[model samples]
Target: MSGLSTTWFGVIRSTIDGNVALSDINLGDPDGNEIVHDTIGKNLICTNMFPAPQIGDADDGIPDPSYPFSTVGRNVIGQCGFVLAP
Candidate 1:
């Protein structure tokens, strides 16, 4: 994912259900690609798959206070975004 327009977002409002394994999503992959603007929403349980963000938790896969989010710390959106401890 390279040469994206300024108006486009890298990721937004995505959901991950049971049994799906994900990690390091768009973590400077494809040689030299870094998702600068992304808002991802996930519905996952427990451990194993985690978005290992290197540009700080708030700036990477995790949510932060930006154009998409109104405030800081709150990354996940929607009711399903909340994960219950299993």
Candidate 2:
């Protein structure tokens, strides 16, 4: 028997208020293995993968002001500039 292996790579950019402007971004990867330089922000290498957090209404049917929930937290696999590999 033989084992199989595969690899994947990509880049991610994020902002605090989801107001990041694309015009300020300029990214290019001279080498396929990694990014050479980026003007937008720091470049992070892919490390791990996990399911994003889930959001739902409160048990009492009332929104909690202290712990409000939003769609922004959903579907977000990682922090800003996070990368994932398969």
Candidate 3:
């Protein structure tokens, strides 16, 4: 696993198994407003995703355990972003 970052209340843990390679990934909210967590994985390949969100707007570089919107699994990410949603 490589290239992982968070904005505000962001906490992440990566566990590598078998053979895997990850790059430029920011699992949960771009600003890390949510608790983005990752578990065991095997034979995986990822890149160019999970960028930090703009300053302010709830994610003020603070860790808020009460913030919702956690969990970044069971999804197909190929460039589209959650921040770009309506």
Candidate 4:
């Protein structure tokens, strides 16, 4: 199976108007995409976007449990960013 490691930076806060605003999230690589978990009645409750897992299998290039990490569909925290690996 093919796997991918991605790096994404973004903020996280309540969707309410004028709420306690969280800012400045600099997540490193192996960080997966954002995951929206709505336990509460509302939507966009929490921003669960962690980095991708360390590449390589248990020994070889086998993907770990956290495979197919994507940087798509992340809510606007405040600002977001990403840098291309040279």
Candidate 5:
């Protein structure tokens, strides 16, 4: 028989709003100084999604052990989700 295989998935959601500005000015005769300014105004929101695992009873011939199946499910839910931003 082949060895057991496993996979994991996950996702994250966030939204960001901000502003950026750049400016340069020169004043003098022939030689002048350059000035630059950057400013940002933002609002951000972040969320994490996780789900519970499903398991069957041992008498039902389902794998009740918490090594591979359960672990995989937990990992998947813990790491899988979606993000919404505008």
Candidate 6:
């Protein structure tokens, strides 16, 4: 399927799990580049998925001053206003 539009303005299920799936998401197709997502028209597309975990706690006397995140270097937001040039 070289020219098949299996991902044309539609949501695709990229992954799944048994009994532990975290709500299957619909992340449309990739634009010119088959890696970046296209959310230009999808009004429900959110920019930030989760806020960077803070290191301080309100009850703690001293702040931890350190943020330990497992997925800090990954881009989660879908690309908006992206157009495939013809």
User: Quick one: best lDDT, which candidate?
Assistant: 3
lDDT for model 1 comes to 0.28
The C-alpha stretches of model 3 lying farther than 4 A from their native spots are: 1-56, 79-86
lDDT by candidate, in order shown: 0.28, 0.24, 0.39, 0.27, 0.19, 0.23
Candidate 4 global lDDT: 0.27
Higher-TM-score candidate of 4 and 6: 4
lDDT of 4 by residue, 1-86 (tens): 11222355322211333322222323554543332211112212222333422222221344333332223233333222221011
Worst 10 residues of 1 by lDDT: 45-54
The clash number for model 3 is 1
Clash list (residue pairs), candidate 3: 26-50
Candidate 1 — which residues are off by over 4 angstroms?
A: 1-12, 23-52, 55-63, 67-86
Steric overlap count per candidate: 0, 0, 1, 8, 5, 0
- The global Cα lDDT (0 to 1) of model 3 is 0.39
lDDT of 6 by residue, 1-86 (tens): 11222323222212212111111223233231121212223132223212211111321334222421112122333332121211
* Model 3 Cα lDDT, one tens digit per residue, 1-86: 46665544432444434433445656555444322333323333344546532222443456455542223333423432232112
- Per-candidate TM-score against the hidden true structure: 0.21, 0.17, 0.23, 0.21, 0.13, 0.14
lDDT at position 11, candidate 3: 29
Q: Comparing candidate 2 with candidate 3, which one achieves the higher TM-score?
A: 3
lDDT of 5: 0.19
Give the winner by TM-score: 3
lDDT by residue for model 1 (62-82), tens? 555452431113333222232
Candidate 6 residue pairs in clash (backbone atoms < 3 Å) = none
Number of the candidate with higher TM-score, 1 or 5: 1
- Candidate 5 displacement at residue 3 in angstroms: 30
Model 4 stretches astray by more than 4 angstroms:
1-20, 30-33, 39-86
TM-score of 5: 0.13
Q: Among all windows of ten consecutive residues in candidate 5, which has the lowest summed lDDT? A: 31-40
lDDT of 2 by residue, 1-86 (tens): 01212232222222233321211122232221221112223322222221211121221345445533322322332232322211
lDDT at position 13, candidate 3 = 44
